[model samples]
Target: MELNSIKDAFDRVAKKQKLSCSKSQEVIDQIIQEIEKALGKIQPSLSDYKHVLSDLRTTLKDIAPLSQLEGTQKELNIALSKYAKVIEKSFNPDIAKAYRNIEFDVHTVNQIIAIHFYRQGFFDIGDCFISEARELESAASIKSSFLEMFQILEAMKHWNLEPALNWAANNSDKLKQNGSDLVLRLHSMQFLEILKKGSRNEALKYARNHLTPFSSDHMAELQKLMACLLFTGRLDSSPYSALISPTNWEKLAEELSKQFCNILGYSFESPLSVTIAAGVQGLPPLLKFMNVMAGKKQEWQTMKQLPVPVELDKEFQFHSVFVCPVSKEQSTDDNPPMLMPCGHVLCKQSIMKMSKNSTKSFKCPYCPSDVEATKCRQLYL
Candidate 1:
C-alpha cells in the first residue's frame, strides 16, 4: 500500500511538473513573438530608431510578458516544492530502524550471491565474484549448469533450437517426473518453424519422430498444431493465425528456462531476485511498525517477529504458512501445527497450553471431543 501511494504521489508530481513547464513555455513563446514583432517594426524604421524604441517600450508594457512569465515560474516553483514534500511524506527516511543486526555466514552469503549471478546468466561476473570470495571451487558445478542453460537461451535468440532440443531429450525423464511437457513443446515449435519454411513433408516427418511420444497425452494440443500445417507458408492468413504469434516465442523461451531450472532443482527466479522482490513488498509494513514502536519507546530490532502482519503477494509465497486458529500465531519449527485425532489442527504450543503439556485432557476448541497433546501428531504443511 505504501509503495502504491508513493507511486501515485510521484505521478501527481510529474503531472504538475509537466503542466508547469508547459505553461512556462507558452508564456516564453508569447514573449518571444512580441519581441520579434517589435524587432520587425524597428528593422523597417532604422531612420526613426528613437521613435521605434519608444513604441517598443509601449508595446512591452501593453503585453506585460514579464508578469505572465513570473506567474508561470512561480507555479513551477510551487509544484517543485510540493513534489519534494510529497516524496518526503510518501517514504520514511528512517528505514534503517526496521533492520535487525544479526550474524550471517560470509561463505554462505558469497555462495548465494555467486549463484545468483550465475543463474541470471552473468557468467563472467559470477566467476569474478566467486573468485574474489574464494568460492570458485564450491560454485563451479552450479555455474556449469547455468552456463548450459544460457547457451540454450543464446541459441534461442538467433532462432536456433538444436541445443535446446538436445538438452530436452537428455532430461526427458526428469521433465516427465517434473510434470513438464517441454519435449512436446520444443518439438511443436520446431514443427511450426518447418511449416513456416513451406516444408510440409519435413514438418510431418519431424512431428512423427519427435512429437510422437506426446501424441496420446496431448492429442488436443497436437490437433491444433497440426491445423497450422494447412496454411504452410501463409500461416499469418490462416484460421490458425495465432499459432505464429510473436508472443509464442517469448512464452516458449520462458517455459524452457523454467523447466531447465526445475530439472536442476532450482526455481526459475534467482533467489536474489525473489528475496529482493519479497523484501520490497514487506518493507512498508516493517517501516510503519518501527515508527509506531518509536512513539512507545520500544525496541523492535531485537524482536523475532513484527507486531503487524506483512501481507505479500501470492508470487512471493514459496511454502505453506499455517496460522494457529487458537492463538492466531503463524506456525514455526518450535510451534509446528499439530493434527488432533478429532481432525482439528492447532499449533503445538496452543495444544500444549490447553492440555497442560499432555498431563490432562481438555475439550477441543472447535469440537466437543476431549483432546490430549500426546494424541496430536505434528502436521507438516
Candidate 2:
C-alpha cells in the first residue's frame, strides 16, 4: 500500500510539470498504455512530438510592463506637439495641413502661422497687425507704439499726422529716458526729413525744440544738419560761421563736387569756394594728380611726356628721365629710343634693318639671342 502511494505521488508531480489537466491526464494515460502495449509488436522507434514542451514553459516569464511603455508614448506626444508648429509653417500647403491636424495647443501654432503668412508675402505689416488684433480680440495702443509710429511715418507725407508728431514731440523726454538708441535715430532722421520742407524759422525752431541736443562727439551729425540747412537755403552763410572752418570748408567742397557731379555731369576740378560736407576735407592723392594734370598749360598738356634721353653711350645705351604717361608728345626734341630686352636702345633705322630679315629671325642688336619677333608688340610711338 505504501509503495502504491509513492508511485501515485510521482505520477501526480509529472502531470503538473507537463501542465496536463485532470481530464486530459486520464486520456494521456490511456494513450501511453496503448502505446506501451503496441511497442512489443511495433518494429521502429519515433519521437513523441516535434516541439519541446520545456521551451514552451520557458517563454511564459518575460512579459513587458504597460507603465514604462505608457511613459514613452507620453514623451513622444510632447515631442510631436513641438515639431508640429514648425512643420505647419512650411511653404508646402499639404505639409501645413498635415501639421494642423496634429493635436497641440493653438496659441504658438497660430503665431507661427501668422509669421509664415508675413514671410510668404501674403500680408503687409499694417494688415498683419490688423489681422493679429482681430484674431486675438484685443485693442492695440495707437500712439508711439512701434507699429503705430512706423505706419505714421509710412503715410506721413500724404497723411497729416500732426497728432502723431505732437505725441512724439511731447514724449521726447520720456523717449530719451526709456527708448532705445535705434528709436532715437529713427526719430532724428524723420525730424530732419520733415524739417527739410518747413519754413526757415519754423524748421529751425522745430528742429531745436523736438530733436535731442547734439553731442560734441557727434560732430558729424551736427555738420550734416548744418549742411542740410545751408543746402536748402534755410540759413545764410553768416549763421553757419561757427560750423565752417577751413578744413570743414574743404570737406564741404568735395561733398558738393561729388553731389553736383552725380546730379549734373562733371565734378569741379577744384573747390567752388562754397560750403561742402565736413568729412572730405583732405584731397585724395588721385584728385591731386588729376588737378595737376588738368592745370597743364603747355602743348604736352593733352599728351603723355615720354622718357627723355639725358645721356647716351657709344654702345647705344641711353639713360632717360622718367615722366608721366599722360605727357608724351612726338613733337618733343628730346625723344629717346626705346630700350629692348637686351637693355640697349636702337634708333628707327636699326628697327627697320631688323624688319628686313625674312630668312632669319631678328636678333637683338647688342646680344646674339633671337628677338622672338613673332611675340613682339608694336611700339606705341
Candidate 3:
C-alpha cells in the first residue's frame, strides 16, 4: 500500500473538516451576538416585553442563522463522505481473509516465547513460564547462559567492570577467533574508570598490567590513555574531554551484550523480534493478495508458497534466497531447490515434470547430461 497517498487523503479530509467546523462556529457566534444585542435593547417593563420579542424575531430572520448552519452542515457531510471513501479505498477492513486455517506447533511456539523472555533479561518471568509449561526443562540451560550476560550488564550499570573484564579475559581466545576487539575495549574502559577516581598511580599500574598488552594492536588508543594521565581528575576539562561522554559507556555496554550473545551462538536480536518485524512488513502484501483472491473466488489456502512475493527489509533477511533458474520460481520448503548430479540446480517440481513424474530419464535443459529425478538431491539453501 502507498502510505504517503493514504496520508495525503487523510490530511485533505482533516483540513476540510477543520474548515467546516471553524466556519460553523463563526456563523453561530455571529448569530448569538446579534440575538444578545437584540436582548440588550429591551426595556425592563412588561409593556415593552412583547415589542422586544417581536424585534428579536425579525433580527434573527435578518441574520439567517438557520441557512448558514445548513450550509455548514452540508460541507461537514461532504467531508465525512469523502473521508469514509478514502478509508475504504486505502485500507482492507477484513484482514482475516489474509490467512487460512493451519496447524501450529504449540510446544515450539511456547519455547520461542520463553527464549525471547530469557534473551530480554526477564529471567524470573522466563523461569515462571518454564515452570508452568510442560516438558520445557531445556530452556533452563538457555536461561543459564543469559544469566552471565545480565550479570556483566548489571555491574556495568554501577560503574563496575570486574565481571565484564573477567569474562573477557576468560574468553579472550574465543573472542579473537570471532575477530572481536571487545577485550581491549573493556580494558580501556576499566582503565579510564580507575583514572577517574583521582588515583594516578593506580591508573598507571592498571595501564601497564592490562592496557600494555593491547598496545601492539591498538597503540594509538593506548597512547591516548597514557596521555590522559597528565590531566588526572580533570580529564573532562582537558583536551580529551570527548572520552567523557556517557555515550561511550552505553555503546560499550551494548557491544558487550552483543558479543556475549554471539559467543553463545545466538543472534543479537531475539528470534521472536525478527519474526514479528518481518511479519509486519510482509502482511500488507499478503492481505492485498488475499483480497484479490477473494474477489476472484479462487482457492489459495493449500498453496505451498505465497502467490505474491513478500519483500521485507534487508535487516530481516537472515539467510540467502534462491530462485530456480529453470522454472523461475523461488524455493520453499515444499518445493525446495534440488541439485542434480550434473552440477545443475532446478526446482523439484520442474525436475519431476521434466522427468515425466520420475518414470523415465530426461535430458537436462541447460546441459546435454541425461538425468533421473530420483538422482537429484534436495539442497537446503
Candidate 4:
C-alpha cells in the first residue's frame, strides 16, 4: 500500500468509535499485564513477541479496512487503544499489573507519547522507549531516544550529573569483568568534562565521589578535568593532588599543559602553580610548561586572555638532560618540529616535514599558537 493512503486509513480508524474510554483503558491494562507476565515468565522461545505485539498495535489502527469479518474489525480498533496503555505500563516496570483501570486518555499516542513523556519530565517512560528501541534492535531508534534524553539534560542545564557517577560506582565490577575499558574511559572523560563546567558543589561532589577510582591510570585526563572543574567552580579544591605523587608531578604538569593547549588553544609553563592558585592540586605537564612559558613572555596571557603576542625563538633548548642530537639522516626540512615553552627543544619533526604539512595547524614549541611553519623560529638544537 502507498504510505500516504496507509496513514489516512490509520487516521480514520484511530478516530473511529470503538471502545469507550473506560473499556479501552481496561483492555490496555490487560495487554500490559500480559506483556509483564511474558517478561517475567521468561519464555524459552518468544523470539519475536514484542515485534509481533508492536506490529499488531500498528495494524489495529490501519489494517481495519482489509481485515475480514465483523468481530475482527471491532477487535482491531479495541486493540489499538489497549496497546497504548500497555506502553504506559512498559515504561514503569514496578507498576503492578492488577492496578485499576483509569479513564485518563492520553492526548498523544505511540512515538508521540514517548516524546511527550520525555519532554514532560517522565524519564522512566523515556527510558522505556529506549529499552524498547533496543529490544526491537533498532539502532537508529535507540540513538534517537538517547539523544532526546541528552536534549532534556541540556534543557535542565545539568550537564554534570550524579547518574553518571552512580553508574560508575555501581558498575565497577561489571565494567571490569566485561572489559569495558574504552567505553568506561569515554564515559569518565565526558562526565568529567561536564563537571568541570558545572557548579563547584556539584563538580567537587563528582570529584570526591567519582574521581577516586580511575585516578592512577587516567590521571592525566582526570587532572585536566579536575583543574577545569575547580576553575569553573565545579570542584571546591584540587582533590586529586594526593593521587599524583611528587615524583610524578612533572609528568602530571606536562599532561595538563598539553591538554590545556589542546582544549583551549593556550598553554601554561607553570600550570601546576596556576592549578594551585586556582585551588586545584595536580598540574599536568603541558599546563606546567605553558604556564612557565606564558609567564616569561613579554606579554603574559592566562586562560582569561587571548591573542597574545607571538614571538618565535629560533634557538632551541632541550629540557631533558640526556638529550642527544637528532641524526642528520633523520632530519629533513619537511620534518615538522615544535619548540618547547622555554624555547628549549623541538619535538615531533614529522608534523612539520612533508610538503604543505607545515600548513597544518600546530603549537609553537616556545608558545602555543595555531600557526604554520613560516611563523616558527627554526630551532638549531
Instruction: Give all candidates' CA lDDT scores.
Output: 0.84, 0.42, 0.84, 0.45
What's each prediction's TM-score? 0.85, 0.26, 0.78, 0.20
Q: lDDT at 36 for candidate 4?
A: 73
Where does candidate 3 stray beyond 4 Å? 28-57, 100-104, 121-132, 144-148, 154-158, 295-299, 332-380
lDDT per residue as tens, model 2, 1-381: 534555555554554434434434555465455556455434354353223333323322222223424544455455455445444432224211111123656654454444333323345653565565464442132211334433443444343445444644665565455432333343444444454465556656656764546544456765666455654433334454334234543443333223323332222322222212211232232233443454443432333532232222333322343332323333233433444556544443344457563334577755786654333433434
What's the lDDT for candidate 3?
0.84
Which whole-number lDDT from 0 to 100 does residue 355 have in model 2? 53
For model 1, what is the alpha-carbon lDDT of residue 339?
96
In angstroms, the error of model 4 at 87 is 42
Candidate 4's displacement at residue 133, Å, is 16
Residue-wise lDDT of candidate 4 within 242-329, one digit each (tens)?
Answer: 3323334344333322332333222323333333343221123233444456444443222322222222223222232222134222
lDDT of 1 by residue, 108-130 (tens): 88978998999888889999998
Clashes of 2: 10
lDDT of 3 by residue, 114-225 (tens): 8899889898899898888863667868888888889899999888899999999899998999999998888888878877888999999988898888777889998888
Q: What C-alpha lDDT, on a 0 to 100 scale, does residue 189 get in candidate 3?
A: 83
Better of 2 and 3 by lDDT: 3
Error of 4 at 257 (Å): 32
